[model samples]
Target: MQLQAYTFADTTEIKDLVTRTFSDSEGVDEGKLIGNLAFELLTETPEKDVFCFIAKENNAIIGCIIFSRLIFVRDIQVFILAPVAIATEFQRQGIGQKLIRFGLQTLKLNGIELALTYGDPNYYCKVGFQPISEQHIPAPLKLTYPHGWLAQSLTNNPIPKINEKPKCVRALAKPEYW
Candidate 1:
């Protein structure tokens, strides 16, 4: 399988993969929520520094991951990776891992200093993520694991001190509701 920047043609396959994967997981029964999440990633503003990667095999998308800018008080460049998913049949094939590594490399080349993800620490730690703590970076929310609020700095720069929730201009919901 090859991991590449996602394209329009891969949208449907990505959607199908997400649906198949989430159907078995509890509390994720909302189809429109799934669709909106994908839209939020795909339509991310370049000025906001959001990008994505898709895993493909036999010309079909099997997995997807997203990285988006998280604006803090200091203009620090931090990215949040969310909703990494693999097609049910392709689980355990490392497609999701590949997508993440690829995206990380892509972001690092562009001088991004940090990457954050709301995912399993066990899974993400393999790629260098650790729990966000008061000593390093403050929690994005008061929330904690198995919710997977993890962070890793890709550079030597210290994680910025965040006194409050980062301002989020985009709603994760649909445009009509905004």
Candidate 2:
């Protein structure tokens, strides 16, 4: 499979992929929830605030991931990974991890200081994520799974402490996602 940045023309297909993939794994309700989230992230977020990557085979998208800016009171450059999806058949093949690594590398090149994600610690830990506490970097919304709040510094410096909570994009502003 090939990893690359997503294009505008691929928006609908990407949304569908995320929806179908999540639905198959997490049930219909979750599939629709994440699908809508993906749609909003692609269509509503500012270009500068989001980065989307896809994994494809034979020109067909098989996996997708999104990273959106997490704005803080300070001028720190941080982004959050969320709502990743791999086609049901593509899971366990490492496509998700590869796509995430690609996205993180791209973020580092673009000068991102840190990356955060809320997800399965076991899976995310494979890609260098570590469990972080709210005291270290406050989340925009109260986290239901505080242990899943993870982060990694792209720079040599360690993850810094932020006095104020960060703000996510409108699509991820809801509490249910946090």
Candidate 3:
């Protein structure tokens, strides 16, 4: 399998992969929601505010992940990882984790300081994410599952404590997403 940066041609396949993977694990409705979310994050969001990555095997997209910039008043570079999905047939083979790691490494190489994500802490923990309180680094919106807020320093230093609430990219600004 090869990890690749997303291109316009990958849009349809990426959406289908996210939709089908979530439909298999979650319900069809949830699959649709995330699939739409991924599409918006790609097509609607500004290029400067988003990064998309994919895992492919023989030119077929098997998994995908997205990271959107989080703007804060203070000068700091941060991004949020979200809506990760791996094709149903490819799940449990570490493809998702590998894709995530590749995405994070790219972000780090580009000088990103902090990386945050909201999801299953147990799964995220394996990739260096730790439970982070909103008080430490406020999310764009009130979190429905506060405990799921996780973060890790992409740089060598620790994540700084910032009370200023950060704003997520337009595609991820919806209340339902927080």
Candidate 4:
């Protein structure tokens, strides 16, 4: 498999890959829910505020990751990764971590200072993410599973404390998502 940025032409395939992957792992309803979320993230979010990467094998999508820009009171550059999906058959093969590392490296090159994600601490930690508290960097909304909030500094500096809450793109602004 190879990693690359996703293009508009890959829309339907990307959505299907995400939906099927999620459905296989989570449940049918969750698959549809996240599938719709993926579509909105691609179609509704401002072009400058979001980025997507994919893993393809023999020209077919098998994994995908989406990063949306986050706004904070400080002038720091930050992004939040959400709704990652790899083909159910591809799980535990390091594709997700590889995709995430690639995305982080690309973002760092473009001057992004921090990357945040809400997910399993054990899985994320393997990719340099560490559990972070709202006291250090507040999220855009209330986190139902606070322990899942995580972050890692792209730069050499440590994750800094922010006094203000961050703002996420409209597609991810809903309470249910957080």
Q: What are the per-residue Cα lDDT tens digits for candidate 4 across 15-130?
A: 89989998998899989988888888999998888889999999899999999999986799999999899999889999999999999999998899999999999999999999
Per residue, candidate 1 scores C-alpha lDDT tens digits across 36-125 of 576656665564467778888898788888777777777577888866778778988777777888999889888898888766788998
Model 1, stretches more than 4 Å misplaced?
27-32, 44-47, 134-136, 139-147, 158-160, 173-178
> What lDDT, from 0 to 1, does candidate 3 have?
0.92
Where model 4 places Cα greater than 4 Å from the true spot, the runs are: none
Alpha-carbon error at 30 in model 3, in Å?
Answer: 0.7
Give the TM-score (vs. native) of candidate 3: 0.98
Model 2 stretches with alpha carbons more than 4 Å out: none
lDDT by residue (tens digit), candidate 3, 52-123: 999999889999999999999889999999989988888899998899999999999988999999999999
Each prediction's TM-score versus the true structure: 0.81, 0.98, 0.98, 0.97
Q: Which residue ranges in model 3 land beyond 4 Å of their true spot?
A: none
Using lDDT as the measure, the top candidate is 2
Please list the Cα RMSD from the true structure of every candidate, rounded to 1 decimal place: 3.7, 0.7, 0.8, 0.8
- At residue 103, candidate 3 shows an lDDT of 97
Say which candidate scores most in TM-score: 2
Error of 3 at 149 (Å): 0.2
Candidate 3's error at 35, in angstroms? 0.4
Q: Pairing residues by index, what is the TM-score of model 4?
A: 0.97
Q: Answer with 2 or 4, whichever has the higher lDDT.
A: 2
